[model samples]
Every structure is written in structure tokens, then in C-alpha cells.
Target: MKLAIVGGGSTYTPELIDGFARHRSALPLEELVLVDPDPRRLELVGGMARRMLAHAGHPVTLTTTSDVRAGVDGADAVLLQLRVGGQDARSADETWPHEAHCIGQETTGPGGLAKALRTVPVALSIADVVREHARPGAWIVDFTNPVGIVTRALLEAGHRAVGLCNVAIGFQRRFAAALGVPADDVLLGHVGLNHLTWERSAVVGGVDQLPGLLSERLGELAEEVELPAPLLAQLAAVPSYYLRYYYAHDEVLAEQLAAPTRADAVRAIERELLDLYADPRTVTKPEALERRGGAFYSEAAVELLVQMSSSAGSPLDSPAGRPRVVNLRNDGALPFLPDDHVVEVPAVFHDGRFVARDVEEVPVEAQGLVAAVAAYERLALEAAVHGGRERVLSAMRSHPLVLQHERAEKLTDLLLAENARFLPWAR
Candidate 1:
């Protein structure tokens, strides 16, 4: 099958290629096309992918191109993994609104708003490319950040898309490791939205394990917390940077403030990564992989085709004796929230079809938050697509944290002024 990876120049290209190569026997990738605007980076990643494929003894044809149209033409699956702007842009995103409001910019705070504004256009453009060139019924897997929002855009555009985040899988693996169980033996039920998702329930050895039992050993789970925010938050609900910001503001900020913020502190760790990539090493080199690790995150985006096309006409039965993913609307599946939001759950896939496991309602408090975020998400999209300042304001108002800050008006004013480049309606 022809598979195209957009943003092939990304630092994660090596890891993705490695993943594809590792799973080639199952997916049987025949042609791999790497697309990026930077020719130098494209050559670098392309060379690495080819090397990996060769090492795997997979006779997959490899192609590299700077043009999306050319690279994606007739592709079975197109992976969208581009960065709108790199770290420098993120630094700006983190610092801008915070500098304006005397509050530090955060992942989901005003900083997230600004970053999303900068990102949506590029995301839409990539979707447009797929619309023009992808094979009929091709799948578009988005590994972009602010995944909930990006996935919404693709769904709105009537594209077959699913957002893939590796955090859940990484945490699941960590949970198994912590329990001294095989990774495949863990069964997990995931809930919440985007990075906010929690492993609502987990089963080990066919026994249900409550998160409370696991949280008792806080020290042991620190590494897992460091994996990603949503998963980390689920595991460590009361403390830590990511969840604390959303829930326990005073405590989380204090922790961050106490930590070193100097550029040297940040760059010290980055220097090691840069050094690894700087080495003219082969793709299979450990040093190269270590450097590439941070950029890749342990997540992967496998087109349904790769899984379904290759499967032996059986439904993609949900893995048994372990937690698996099942996607469904939020209404009957989740008692607390409205019925229409798309949620992922543990399920079995057999043949090519999926059967999601039923889940109980989320707690009232949690459901309320999800509802608020969903409402805001809808309004944000409406404000962006149509023109409505009130819609945007209402959405922001609905966010409990925004109200808690009492800076909603100020944030709204600042966002309207700063985001004019993206939200022309605000003007």
C-alpha cells in the first residue's frame, strides 16, 4: 500500500519510519513517501527511512518530495504531523498572553488560543491537499497538538480523520511496567477529552484495579506522570504541573515557579538532543534515536487501511484480556454529557469492525468540565468559521477556569486584539 507522511522533515520522522518498518509485516507497506518543504530535512529523513526499511528487509519503495500534491497523490493513507511553528513559536505562545496578563501562558490558557489560531490555517491547507490528491476513501490520521480541535476541523470538513495521541498508550505501558505485568495484559477504559483523558478504569490479570490503589505509590508513578499531561493528570489528579494548572492553580504554579526557568536550564537538556542529531549517524544508530525521541513521543498514526486492508477480512476485534480502544458518541455511552461528542473507549476489533465496551457515566464534576470544554470548542470553531465575537465570549465564559481567573474579559480583549490575524471576525 502507498502511504504518505506529511511533515517528513519533522524530528519524529525517524521514529515513525522505525514504527512502520517494525510493523511492515503486518501492514506490508509497499511504498513510503516522505513529504516536507525543506529539501535538506526531507533528504535527511528520507535517507533514514530508506535505511530502516532496508534493515528490516522490507522491499518498500521509498520516495521523498517537497511537494505535497506530488507526494500524496494516490496514497492510501496520509499522516499529518506538521508543526505550524517550532519551539520558538511555542515560546512566543507561552510567553505572550502571560506577559500581557501577568499570568504565565499555559498549554490550554490564552497561549493555547494563540497557538491554535496560528495552526488552524495550516491544518486546513493540509486537509485540502488530501481532498485533492488522496486515494478514494483514504484515511487521514492527525497527530497534531490541540488534537481535539484539529480533529473537529477534519470532521467538519467531511474528511475521514482520527486524532492519534500516544500518551494513552505510553501510560498504559507504564502502568503495566509499574505492575510488573506484560503490557498486553493491561485493560484500560479511557475517558475525558484530548490530553485531559484519564484511564477511568484498568484491569490487570482480569481483575479491576482502581486508580486509587495505584496512586498510593506516588513516587513509583512519577515517571508515568512525566509522559504526557492528560495521562499524567489521570494518574496524579491532585498535584503536578499539567493537571494542577487546570484544577489546583495555586499549587501547580508554585511548583513551576520554584523550578529553574533560566534559558540555560532549558538549553542544557536540549544540548544533549542536538548533539545526538548532529552526529552523521545511520538511521539505526541509538544516538540518532535518542535525539529523535522527544520529537516523536511514543505515539503512532496507523491508517485504518494499514490495519483493515491487511487484516484477513475479519473485524479488527478488540484485543482480549487487555484494555483496547472503542470510539462512540458521548450520549448513551457517557451519562454526564450530551450524546454527540465523539469519544474513544476500550473495545474489541475483529475482522475489520470494532465493538466498543460500554462505560458508566462520568462523575458529575468531571462531566461538567467536559461539557464546558465541548461547548467552548464548538463556539471557538463557530467564531473562527463564521463571525461572532459574542460566540467566542460565551465559549470563554463557559470555561470554568476562565471564570475563576476573573480575567475573562481581559483575556477576551487580548485574544481579540492579538488573534486578529487569524480571527478576522473579532475585528
Candidate 2:
């Protein structure tokens, strides 16, 4: 099999290389392509990847290219992990939202909208290229921010694609470690959109251990997710750390105001990781990448790619694969959502495609929030595809965070101004 990584220059690529080296049997490969526009970072990351693969004795042929068409040609699967504007743009996304007294996050509110507008266009363009040049029945696995909006763009555009995020896998790994069980043995009642989600149940060995974890591991769990202990107990569900931007808006805003932006921190981390990658002696994923966030992302990608590789027409396309969390079409999984709406939930491979598991246990209080934010996502995608100041403002105004007219107006102007240089259409 041939696999292509679109953003092969990223510091996170080595982690993925490590996963592939360790799980070659799951998704055996004949060739690996790293496609990126920038030549310098691409070579640096590629060098690290080559050394890592050789050290593990994984004989996959690896190539790096700046040409997207050439890199993905005849590839069985394409992984979209590109950042349209790089970290400088992300720093803008995380910084400008604070001008409107909004939580400065790259994937939740105004920042997420800004990212979606920039990312959706590029994501669609890449998917189109994959459709035209990649192998027949190839799959595009999106690891981009604002995953719901990006995945929706791909699916709506009639591409064979699915979205992957690490949050659910991180939860499963965390719960399994806490309960002294294998990660695969842990089942989650995880539901909602990409970053917007809550874990209502963590079942290990067919027993719900969420209640026990919340009660017995209150401080530990609450501290990890950055939510207050009382809230977790009251809701009886564990909301992902992203939910802090909603549940404790004021508190998180204060912290953002005082602390340095996450983008700045990540940039520093990337610099260190790249420096390490440039070293020929460093042949493995670095320790510092752990602090760079997106935990367990490599593992999640491996599992998703394995499933996609085994789907219809592929050599391994037989036997239903194990269930895994994915961002896919709702199709009544959430009854309250439109069939075309994208949701993050456990999905099983069946009949040559992934089928979302029914979600019947979302916390009652979270239903309204999910529906409300989902509405904003619709408008956000609209603004992303068809650019207009009014459309952007409409999406911003509809968001639960920047709902007020004045705040939305300010945020819209700030977002456009901050991102104008990097915006796909503006260029």
C-alpha cells in the first residue's frame, strides 16, 4: 500500500512515523510519500522519518516532495494534516479572539471560525487533487482543526473522507490506564462534534466506571480536563478540556489573559522538535513532542488508516473491523441533528464503509449546547466556502461565545484583519 501525508514538514510527523514503524502489520506499506510546499522543513522531517524507519528495520520506501499531485499519485490513502497559514496564523487565531473578550482557542469559537475559513478551501482543493490523481477508492483522513467543518466540506463535496481527532483516544487511554485495563478494553460513551464533546460513560469490561472515576479520582480527573470537580459531579459526565471554554468561560478567559497563548508555546516546542529532527543521531520521536499536545494522535491515525485500508476493494477488505471513534455524518445518530451534520462518535466498519454507532446517551443539558454550536458550524462552513464579511459576522454572531452584536462585530473585524494576509482568497 502507498500512503501520503500532505503536511509532512510538521514537527508531529515523527510521532506518526513511530506509529507506522510499530504497527506495520496493521497497515503494511510499500511506499510513504511526504508532501509539503516548504522544502526545508520537509527534508528535516523526512530525514528523521527515514532514520526512524531504518532503526526499526521497517523497509518502507519513503519519498519527500513539494508537488502534491506527484506525491499522492497512486497512493491508497492521503492524510490531510496541513496548516494553511502555519503557526504564525494560529498565533493570530489564538490572540485576536481575546480582543472581543472571548476565549482564545484554535478550535472552539472565533478562532475556530477563522481557522475554518482558511482551512476549508485548502482542504477541498487537496481532496479534489486526491480524487483526480490518487488510487481508486482512496480515503482522505483529515487531522485538521475545526474537524467538523473540514470533514463536512469533504463529505459535502462528495469525497471519500473521514475525520480523526485524538481527544476520544486520549480519553480511552486515560481511562484504561486509570482502571488498570488495556486501552482497547475501554469503551467510551463519547459524543458530540470534533472538539465539542463529553464522555458520559467510560465502560471497562462492560461496567460503567465513569461514576466511580469521577468520585474516587475527582481532583485528578478534574485537574486533567481543567474543569471544576463540582461541575463534573453535577453533570455526571466528563466534558473534554475544550468544554472549559464554555463551562467556565470567565475563568478560562482570565487565564488566557494572564498566560501566554498556546500558539506561542507550540511554536517554541516545534522549534526544539525541529532542531532535534535535524540531528541525524535522533532517530525516534522526541520526548518534548508530548508537551506539544494532540496526545495519542499517531495511534488514532494508525487505527483509522488500518480500517480504511481494509475497506472494500483493498486486499484486506474483509471482516468487520473493531469500533473506533471518528468524525462522520450524523445520519440520525443524534436524532436532533440533520443527517448531513458531522459528529464525533464510535463507528464500526461494515459493508465496506464506516457506520456511526447510535448515540442515545448525551447529557440532557449538553443537547442544547450541541445543537446551538452545530448551528454556528453550519454558518461557519457557509462563510468558509463563500467569503463575505456579512457571512463571517453571521457565523460569529451565532456562536455561543460571541453572540452579542457588539462582540461579534468586533471579533469579525479582528479575525479578518488578523488573518487577511493568510486568508486563501485574500492572497
Candidate 3:
């Protein structure tokens, strides 16, 4: 199999290379192509990736290119990991939202809207290139930020795509470790739109162990979710860390104001990572890469690809039974949301697509938030594909974080002005 990574120059590339090396047997590769527009980053990251592959004794052919069509040609699958306008744009996204007293997060709130507007167009154009050049029936595995929105745009454009996020798997690993079980044995009742999800139960051997785990390890679970233990007990569900911005908005905004933005921290980390990659002796993925975030990303991405590829023989086959959390169109998985809405839920690979596992109805407590966020996401996608100040403002107003009309209008202006360079339509 030939796999192409569209944003192969990212600092995250080496970690992915390490994953492919470790799991080479499960998903054998004839060729691995790294595609990026930045030649300098491609050289540094591609050099490290080759070294890592060699160190692991995995002799898969490695190649690099700036041309999307050339890299994707004949490829069985293409992975989208590119960040439009890079981390500098992200830095601005994270910093500017504070002016409206909103959470300055890259995947939610006003900042996420800016990112979606910038990313969706680029992702669509690349998808077109892949459609024109990749092997027939090839899948587009998107690891891009604002996964829900990007995945929605891809699917809406009639492309074969699925979004991948590391949050659910990260929680699975942590829960598995605490329970002394394999990560695959840990089943999470993870549901909602990407970045806006909650784990209602953690099952082991067909038995829900979340209640006991919560009772015995309340402090530990609270610390992991970054919420108060009492709150966890009260809610009887574990929200993703991103939920902290919504549940404790004022407190989080205050903290964000005091600390340096995450983008600033990432920039510093990327510089150090590049320096390490430049060292000839540094072949293995450095431990420092952990601070760069996206923990368990490589594992999640590899598992999804392997599952999808293994089912190629029967394009419409149902899953073999094990469920994995994925971001794809709802198709009634949530019941409450529209079928076309992109949601992150526990699903299994069947035939050549993802079939969302039957879920117990969403809890009453989560219904309103889930529906509201899904609505906002739809509006966001519309604005992203067909740019207009009013559409942008409407999407902003629909978000739970920016619900007021006046605030949404103000944020719309700020977003348009700050992200002008990336949002060509807005400019």
C-alpha cells in the first residue's frame, strides 16, 4: 500500500513515522510519501522519518514532494494533517478571541470559526487533487483541527472522508491503564460532535465500570478531566477537557489571560523539535515531543487506516464488532441531530465505511448542548464554503460560547479583521 501524508512537514510527522514502524506488520506499506509546500520543513521532518523507519528495520520506500497530485497519485489512502497559515496563524487565533472575553481555543469558539474558514477551502482543494489523482475508492483520513467542521465540508463536497481525533483514544489508554487491561478492551461510550464530546460509560467485559471507577477514583478522574470531583459525580459523565471552556468559562478565560497562549508554547516546542530532528543521531521520536500535544495520535490514525484498508475486499461490509471512536456523518447515530451532521461517536468499520454503533439515547443533560453545537457547526460550514460577513456572524451567534447577537457581530468583525490574510474571501 502507498500512503500519502499531505502535511508531511509538520513536527508531528516523526511521531506518525514511529507508529508506522511499530505497526508495520499490521499495515504493510510499499511506499510512504510526505507532501508539503514548505521545502525546509519537509527536509527536516522527512529526514527524521526516514531515519526512524530505518532504525526500526522497516524498509518501506520513503519519498517527499510539494506537488499534491504527484504525491497522491497511485496512493491507496491520503492523510490530511496540514494547518493553513501554520502556527503563527494559530497564535493569532488564540490571542485575538480574548478581546471579546471569549475562550481563545483553536478548535472551539470564535478562534475555531476563524480556523474553519481558513482551513475548509484549502482542505477541499486538496480533496479535489486527491480525487483526480489517487487510486479509485481511496479514503481521505483527516487529522486536521476543527475536525468536525473539516470532515463535514469534505463529506458535503461528496468526498470519501472521515475525521480522526486523539482525545477519545487518549482517555481509553488512561482508563485501560487504571483498570489493568488492554486499551482495545476498554470501550468508551464517547458521543457528540468532535471537540464537544463526553464519555458516559467505560465498559469492560460488557459491564459498565464507570460507576465504580468514579466512586473509587473520583479525584484521579477529576484531575484527568480537569474538572472538580463533585462536578463529575453530579454530572455522572466525564466531559472532554475542551468542555472546561464551556462549563467553567469565566475561570478558564481568567487563567488563559494570565498564562501564555498554547500557540506560543507550541512554537517554542516546534523550534526545539526541529533542532532535535536536525541532529543526525536523533533517529527515535524524542521524549520532548510529548509536550507538543496530540498524545496517542499516531496510534489512533494507524488503527483507523488499518481497519479501513483491511475491509477493502468488501466495500460495504459491516464492522467485525470492535468499536472505535470516529468523526463521521451522524446518519442517525445521535437521533437528535441531522443525518448529515458530523459527529464523534463509537463506530466500527464495515464494508468500506464507518457504521456508528447503536447508542443509548443521548442523556437529557447533554441534549441541548449537543444540538446547539451541531447547529453552529452547520452554519460554520456554510460560512466556510460560501463566505459572507452575515453567515459568519450567524454562525458565531449560534455557538454556545458566543450566543448574544451584539457579541457575535463584534466577534465576526474581529475574526474577519484578524484572519484577513488566511480568509481570502473575507478580505
Candidate 4:
């Protein structure tokens, strides 16, 4: 299969190369294309990717190009991992929201809104190219931030797309290690929108082990969620770490205020990674990339792609129906949310598409929060597609973190001002 990575210059690309090297038997990649606009980073990352593949004796042809159409042409699948404005823009996204006392995060609150506005247009443009030039019925695998909004945009635009996030896989690995099982044996009852999700149960051998995990491994679970153990016990669900920003907004904001922005830290790591990638002798992904975040991203991407490509007759098919957590249209997977809205839920790939598994009724405790965030995501999508200050402000106002009209108004202005260089519509 021919696979194209649209943002191949990213520091994270080497990790993906490593995954493909290790899982070559499953995917059997023939050609790998790395497409990016930045020639320098593209050359550096592409060089390292080729070396990593060779080191593992995976004989896939590696190529790089600055042209998106040329890179995606006739490819079997296209992966979207582009950051439209790079880390400098992300620095703004992580720093400016603090002025409004909201969480200074890249994927939630006003910051997420800012990223959506900047990213959706670029994502759509790439999708347009893929539609015109890619192999017929090729899938678009999105690994972008604000995935729920971006995936919603893609599905609404009539593209075959599925969003992937590492959070679910991260949880799965942690649970598997803690329970002495393989990662694939640990199934998560992961639900909600991307970045706004919770693990209600960890199932093994067709049985839910969450209750025992909570009771016996409370401290470790709490540390993973970054919240008090009592809080998790009270809810009876383990929330994704991002939820800490909502459940303890004030505390997270105070901590964010005291520390350098995550963007700053990542920028430093990227510099180190780029330096490493530039080394011709370096043939494997560096350990420092682990601290750079997006942990287990390659595994998540490869597993999803392999599942999608696996046919009913293939050995990869799940006889007992093992589901993978992904962001796709609700389609009644979440009854409370609109069918057209995107949700992160456990889904199985069947007949060349992902079908979201039916979920039990959302717990009463989590329903309100999920509903509220889904509503905000809807408004955010609208604002992202059709740019206007009013739509942006309305979306911000709908966010659980910036519910007050005054705060939303201030944040809207701040976001537009900070991101004007990246968002042409804002300018």
C-alpha cells in the first residue's frame, strides 16, 4: 500500500516511521511519501525516516516533496498531521488564553477555538487536493488537534475520514502494564469528544476490571488523571488528563500561570529532535521524543490503519469484536449528542469503514458535561467554517470554561488579535 503523510516534516514523523518498521508485516507498505511545505525540516525528517526503515530492513520506498498534490497522487491513504502555523502559533494558543483566566491549552477552551479557526481551512484545502488526486475511495486519517471539530468538518464535507488520538491508546497501554496484559487485550470504555473523554471501564477477558482497578490502584489512576483519587472514586470514571482543566480550572490555571507554556517546552524539544534528525548516523527515533508528547501515536495510527484495511476474511478481524477508540460521527453511539456530531468512542472497523459501537446510556454525572462540550464543539465548527467575530465569540461563550459573556468577548478579541497572522479570515 502507498501511504502519504501530509505533514512529514514534523518531529513526530520519525516515531511513525518506527511504527511502520515494526508493523511492516501488517500493512506491507510499498511507498511512503512525506509531504510538507518547509523544505529544510522535510529533508531532515525524511532522511531520518529513510534511515530508520533501512535499519529495520523494511524495504519501503521513501520519498519527500513540497507539493501536496504530487505527494498524495495515487496514494492508498493520506494521513493529516499538519500544524498550520507551527509551534510559534501554538505558543500563542497556549499563552493568550491565560489573560481570560481560562485553561491555556491547545485543544480545549478558547485556545482550541483559535486552533480550529486556523486549521479547518487548511485541512479542507488539503482534502480538496486529496479528493482530486488520491486513489479512489482512499481514506483520510486525521491526527490533528481539535480532532472532533476537524473530523466533523471532514465528514460534513463528504470526505472519508477518521480521527485518531493517542489518549485512548495511552490509557490502554497503562492499564495493560498495570494489569499484566498485552495492550491489545485491554479494552477501554472510552467515551466523549476528543480531548474531552473519560474511561468508564477497563475490560479484560470480557469483564470490566475498573472497579477493582479503582479500589486497588487508586493512587496510580489518580496520578494518571492528575486529579485526586477521591474525585475519581466519586465519579466512578477515570477522566482524560485534559479534564483536569475543567474539574479544577482554577488550580490548572494557577499552575499554568507559574510554568512556561507547553509550547515553549515542546519548541525546545523540537529543536533537539531536529538536530538529532540532521545527524546522518542517527538511524532510530531518539528517547527525548518521548518527552515531546504524542506518546504511542505511531502505534495508534498503525493499528487503526491496519484495522481499516483488514477484511472480514483476514486474521486481523476481531471474532469477539475488539473495538478501537476513534473520533467519528455519533450515529447514535451517543444518543444525547446529534447524530451528525463527532464523538470519540470505541468503534470497530467493518466493511471498510468505522462503525461506532453502541454505548450504554451516558452516566447522569457525566451527561451534562458531555452535552455542554458537544454543544460548544458544534458552534466552534460553524465559526471555523464561516469566519466571523460574532460566531467566534458565540462559540467561546458556549465553552464550559468561558461561559460568561464578558470573558468570552475578551477572549475572542484576544484570540483574533493573537492569531491574525495565521488566520487570513481574521485579518
Residue 235 C-alpha lDDT in model 4: 79
Per-candidate local distance difference test: 0.60, 0.89, 0.90, 0.90
Candidate 4, which ten residues in sequence have the lowest lDDT sum? 312-321
Model 4: per-residue Cα lDDT over 242-290, one tens digit each? 9998888999999999999988999999999999999999999999899
Positional deviation of residue 360's Cα in model 1 after best superposition, in angstroms: 4.9
1-427: candidate 1 lDDT, tens digit per residue: 8888888777677777766766676677788888889886776666766766787787889999988899999998888886665555555555444533433442465655555555666778888888888898776777776666776777777776766666556656666766778766766666666655655556776686646545565545544344333443453331222443566555544654555433334345444544444545654634445533333243334423354455425434423212245333344566555565656555443443434464534544566666777776666656545556676666556655576445766666766765565555555
Better of 1 and 3 by TM-score: 3
List runs of model 1 lying over 4 Å from the truth: 100-107, 211-219, 222-241, 254-279, 285-306, 311-313, 316-323, 326-331, 347-355, 387-392, 404-406, 416-427
Cα lDDT, model 2, residue 21: 96
After TM-score superposition, the amount by which residue 240's alpha carbon in candidate 2 deviates from its true location, in angstroms, is 0.3
- How displaced is residue 129 in candidate 2, in Å? 0.4
Model 2 C-alpha lDDT per residue in residues 335-385, reported as the tens digit of each score = 888999999998876656778763546688898999999999999999999
**Which runs of model 2 end up more than 4 angstroms from their true locations?**
311-320, 424-427
Could you tell me the TM-score of candidate 1? 0.81
Residues 176-211, candidate 3, lDDT per residue (tens digit)?
Answer: 998999998888989888998888899998898888
Error of 1 at 311 (Å): 4.7
